[model samples]
Target chain A: MNTPNSLLIRRSRRSSNLSFVALGLVAVGLVMMPYVVYQSVTSSMVMLFVLVIIASMWNLLAGFGGLVSIGQQAYIGIGAYTVIVMADLGVHPLIGVFFGALTSAMLALPTSWLAFRLRGDYFAVGTWVIAEVYRLVMIKFQFVGGADGKSLVGLSGLDPVMRSALTYWFALGIAILTVLGCFWLLRSRIGLALTAIRDDEVSARAGGIDATRIKRIVYLVSAAGCGLAGGILVVDALRVQPDAIFSVSWSAYMIFIVIIGGIGYLEGPLIGALVFFAMQQFLAEMGTWYLMLLGVLAICAAAWFPKGLWGAFSQKTGFRLFPVGYHVAQRFDTPVDSRAPLFRN
Target chain B: MQILDALAQGILLGGLYTLFAVGLSIMFGVMRIVNLAHGDFAILAAFLAILLVGETSFPVWLVVAITVPAFAAIGYFLQRTLFQQSLNSGPLSTLLVTFGMSIVIQNALLEAFSANPQRLDVGQLATASFPVGPIAIPYIGVLGLMLAILCIVAIELFLRRTATGRMTRAVSDDPDTARLTGANSRHIYGLATGIAFGAVAIAGLLLAARSSVEPTAGSMRLIFAFEAVVIGGLGSLWGTLVGGLSLGVVQTLVAHFDPSSSILAGHLLFLLVLAFRPQGLIPARSL
Candidate 1:
């Protein structure tokens, strides 16, 4: 059932305006949480939220930009190690996260130049190989625990309460910024070019969309997100290990969260994470069965709910929670402006 | 002498590599899902064989005999129910589906078999060896090599000679056209998975004979098989055999020189091959 373009356009028009009230309420709720509640967030648990942010970026890249990569952990490891290195030089870990993100973005530049040459699964395999190369190189270096990894608490002079609060705030800010950044980007011209490339790269190129360049931007942004997340992850734990940080499972976890939640929408990871967290709590003792059940759920969801939990929700409810872009009606047929589908071209 | 020794040993390991890659290659060649759960299936077979050992005082060979058919039946059902409808939706969807299956199998195996590692008591075959010029080669190694050769040949003949095999070839080659030609792809995938899992059961026997088994072992085996398939270029069955041998030889040679470098050497070989021959040493016509 192909939807009429005009209806899609009308729908898109309605979702453009931001619901600032909703955004404010959410932001206020987060800020209102006390230090104890903030401290209650463990590094691994908090980092899962960061993973959702990174996955959203990847979803944009692969889902909307059509750049599938299995090696985003390369940037993640790079980001994490960069933080450790910077901190070793006496920089505050919080500030080190920004630098780490920048470093990862810089690394993605050369990688994108090479990876951009490949297409489909070749691109994915190239990324994996590149990640391995990065891992090998990291192993040769001695300062950051090499393959064995190192503790990030070398500068443990900072107060514990302060550390947790700052780390929590940093993670939250990054998460918000990442989500907001994606929302803004998805509405712009580059976002249009990316969406075009995703649908049909050849035709998109023929239409003078610089597919390679847009893909490069998406890649760099995704790297920054993963890198920052990785940095935060290391800082929260005050540890850095190449194998632990760079393991393919890191990216696999991102994929799982994204797939289960909803890859194409911002709300997917949030909903999926809540569900995942609950599942983890209940089935923690089952060990391997827990992983297996999640795997089965992921497979079943992917096969049946390709759009994911949020995607399915949107289709059923026809409601937009975190809508980006919009179909603004020039005629002003509806009062108070309404929400519409964002992907309408 | 050491290099020669390594090469001979690599060839022997290649026998297991053959067992690993052949099943994966066959599934990929036919269904194209990469069967991420392929290695887990091997582990499952090993567990089943161990259970059979407990129930009856049957020879390991007898256990292999019983489990192969049983696993094939399971594979057939899994394909028909889960994989067939989802086959054509591009690689990521399929990859995700298979990955999920892998997790499921691993967890299921853990629950059923517990986390403790088990070893197959192959009596003296593993410890016993045949004398060669200045070197001793184990009988199990030779037996593995022969088994690989026999199975490869049998699969080749089956594909080349049989009607069902021809259908498998046709569907694998041009699925849409095959559909137009009245080939039922789901049934073919079921048959293909059945055969792949069936062979995987035998591979499990050899694996249990060679080393201990546990839940986590499948992913490692999967990586080796995956490397072989990629290195071979999904070119053909023979290519996987060559790929497996080359990988085994690389690992053995490195291990002969230094133990830590063994894993590194195999991974390095993959990187080198991928850089130079991304198409693989030999590629199947369609992969």
Candidate 2:
């Protein structure tokens, strides 16, 4: 749309169109990767995708929605448990992934009621405690393997290579969907409301935004995204352990990735996940030192580079893979009057 | 008889839990900073005591006495530098930086001490207890309770009577306004953090005396302390006491019937409190 000022207003930039095509090409390439890439490489890709999904979900909640929950492992565990338990009951693990998202979103409803009570820092701890509650509760349920955990059954009938390939494919598909989901969500009217609420909740509320409701929606979406990651995680690992699935380390990893990559940017998690994957590949043997390195890196990122690596890069290059903001640019076709006044002045 | 015995034990446990929580309370109350590393620092203090005990021929209590003041100094230094920077960045930065610190400390301890659980040797104090009819109260439990009461009283008195305490409260209430009134918020925050660190170190030492602690033990303590703070109410010291005691009682009572469900019971109680009374059981009227 062009205003009287001869400027066009639009959401998508020229780069976004290019990014869309690039994203498509990458998706197609990744879809064919399992067929050509080594099985071990495929497994690693699955983990990378899982990290990307969770990190993005966390970024959505914390960065955009301003809800910094350190307990998202609650949904991850719930997702894994749901998928594995469904496998026990004669459902295919592939189809169970969607169910995982559904179940997580369902669970997040009750969770938000309890968790949303606490402000800022307290909310983070509240979510974590809630996750702990879920973990402890899951341990008591003997039907789904209880404290000892259970292996993913029903997959034994399929060929090992086929199962791995299927898992890899699902991971890739979901990772793509999660990224696209975030991009689409952020470019919508809800996204506008989210930005308003994040910048100033009181002003946003005064401006007629349903701040609580919008935040709840974002929280549910994030929970669903994490749940999808967890389902794929179970399928990839072929087991479900309450402690392992519900581990706070997942949140740590998510927080670390978001902080280092860029907390509020859509492209941040993708970059952070890649860096994390490379670090993991090289430093897997370092054990606790590797974790310490990650911790130190995260602290440095939060302290020195609050905008994160991508945020800095974007600021310098003025590049964006996904642009969620509306921009105004002067129309080139009608720009002929340098002598005319630019404004009513 | 069993219930009464459990009740006594729970109360003693409550004292230790309060000790774990008060430092966290002060940090939040004063600086509005949630130290995610609170539990890890406690474990770090316990480990420091262990190292001291290993190096010297001194008793564990003496080692703890030495370690507490040292930890206070470290806390003051850390807050003045690292925490102050994060606080300037915003709450997200504070959470991320502290969370990162937590992971770093946990991993460092793991690398230094391995995964093996270590405990402080209290000698006869480990077994010494006084009989109250059917209930036997351990000497260490009584000591912990006494020390907890003393610490709380001391802190309360310090906040009420001392000039530094008044400045700390002013900063807690409004850092900018306090600064306008000639108080240095950063210095006050450092002092608050120092006291918190000292208190938590004592909590850690008592925990080591009570049970074996490993590198990974910090997160559990973090949760317990956090739960106590939330249940009792934020920014209220006595509320923390109440929260800790109730949490202790609930866990013990549940464990008496089903051993595995004790921790779960505490979490449930916290959630119930959150659901019904989000302001906490005894909400803070003033910092």
Candidate 3:
């Protein structure tokens, strides 16, 4: 004796057509943005692409996998160092970018085995230790500038016009590809499993999900993305310091961007990076207080809103900017017999 | 003889490490929260002592007397205001919140006292040392070890002997049951933070006399304390001491042979221990 009005459970779904249209618009907009900015701003644009790419991967891992890590610098350091290692052997950083990621994947393979042993706090600590190990190990390699951090002197001698354009285009392609990859991944069945795992790992496992394999895949992907991004970072900086490249501060910045932009969603780090860059415009002169401010902001965000800005915005607006999948619905006004038939069919 | 000397000194330093870690252990023992700010609090206390002594010309004991209760009060407030509510949210929230508190405290201290390092001139304690079978034992180092032992004994006794101790143990065991038994678990949480702060005070006294005081000193101390806690196992008090000693010995041995290996040696030791036995050296079985 239930009311027909109460029987309708409307699932929110974007028609596959609207989703593709939205993607095309965003692609066009991103393509057109570079002509509108200054030279330094344009140069910095490439850096931002890499930053967002790496931060997005981290955001996906921590925000979705419930695998809160503090040592992602392991991959970043590895990637950059790998690029340098290749460069020492006379491989161009441009060509060695993929190799750098490969190196990160190799490190992650062993690290994931060991780091997976640690749950929660221990995991964070273990990852940090691993990063330290990477840093220490790097110091033992003299070709990459043990402590001094060698300059990419020869790279500068290459045709300046070709080099800059190629690096920019390379970063752009990677950024776009990573974003698309994340979107596709999130829209898939594995994405559904990831969200399920994030919500509750035990239940997800009980539901026949290969939680470990899923997490490993996510970890490996995250590592590879970080590795590629890191190589680009060194190329941009033109030199890589063991301390700076391997710094925990990079991870901290990644945390800051994700927190501010909104974690869990693909666009969180994108928004976060933009917000962080804007804030840096003002807070850059604040010196050490600036770091403290970012930390405090992240803490406040976590304390007040665990769902992050993205979750909060979604709840308030009832709209998703990046719709991964569709929700099919049956109108409440439809006859029960008709609705039942439609559902059954 | 050199090896023996290293071992003895390591054991002695382990005492200080024990002192450094026990307060953190006590907190974790009663409440399953790890204060990422544990080492920072120790450094802060030491700096406070330095400031206190400079201002009032108080003896080190008097400084500790003042700082212990003062820090206990701060810890009590920190728990009552912030952590008490978040306890049920589990460790992640606790870690983030405490990490925030650490940033607040470190920045506040950094602002109050710049990045310049400070040290205490502990009269004879700093330089005074006696030979034990060809090993030089500094008075300050001996003090650190003795304090560590004292800390262990006192905490163990306090946890076992007193009615408050029983209540604490009960609360730690099962908060709901303790609540049913008419113990206010919230108040107990404050007391736990207070006890932790008291232990930090002792560590601060010993640490200031031992090392140069700087803002980042907390994180560094925290690193050792963390390693000790891990080495000792999750919740055991004595194991912390063993953990500290083992870490100290490992570091000393590395330093003795290869100066560069000192920090690396400690990290590798921790990794090796973790690889084989993640349960730690001494696991907290009861709570």
Most accurate candidate by TM-score: 2
Give the alpha carbon lDDT tens digit for every residue of A197-314 in model 3.
9889999999999999999888888898899888888887777888888876677777778877777877688788888887877887986687678767877765565556776787
The candidate maximizing lDDT is 2
User: Which residue segments of model 2 deviate by more than 4 Å?
Assistant: A1-6, A331-345
Which model is ahead, 1 or 2, in terms of TM-score? 2
Best by DockQ: 2
Docking class of 1: acceptable
RMSD of 3: 3.3
Range of the 10 consecutive residues with the lowest summed lDDT in candidate 3 chain A: A336-345
CA lDDT of A289 in candidate 1? 68
Residue-wise lDDT of candidate 2 within B58-131, one digit each (tens)?
98767877899999999999999999998888768988999999999999999999999998777888779999
Per-residue accuracy of model 1 over A1-345 as CA lDDT, tens digit each: 223322334333233235456666867676555443646654445665676677776787677776767789998889889888888898877888899899999999987766665455446655766776678778878887777888885448878877676677778788878877887787778877877887788999999988878888889999988888888888887887787788777666767877888876767777776677777768868787678778878888877777888888788976666655454344333332235543444
Instruction: Give residue A167's lDDT in candidate 1 (0 to 100).
Output: 73
Q: What CA RMSD would you report for each candidate?
A: 4.2, 3.1, 3.3
State each candidate's chain A TM-score: 0.87, 0.94, 0.87
Give the runs in model 3 whose Cα sits over 4 Å from its true position: A1-27, A32-34, A159-162, A324-328, A332-345, B88-91
Error of 1 at B245 (Å): 1.1
Candidate with better TM-score, 2 vs 3: 2
- Which scores greater on TM-score, model 1 or model 3? 3
Cα TM-score of candidate 1 = 0.89
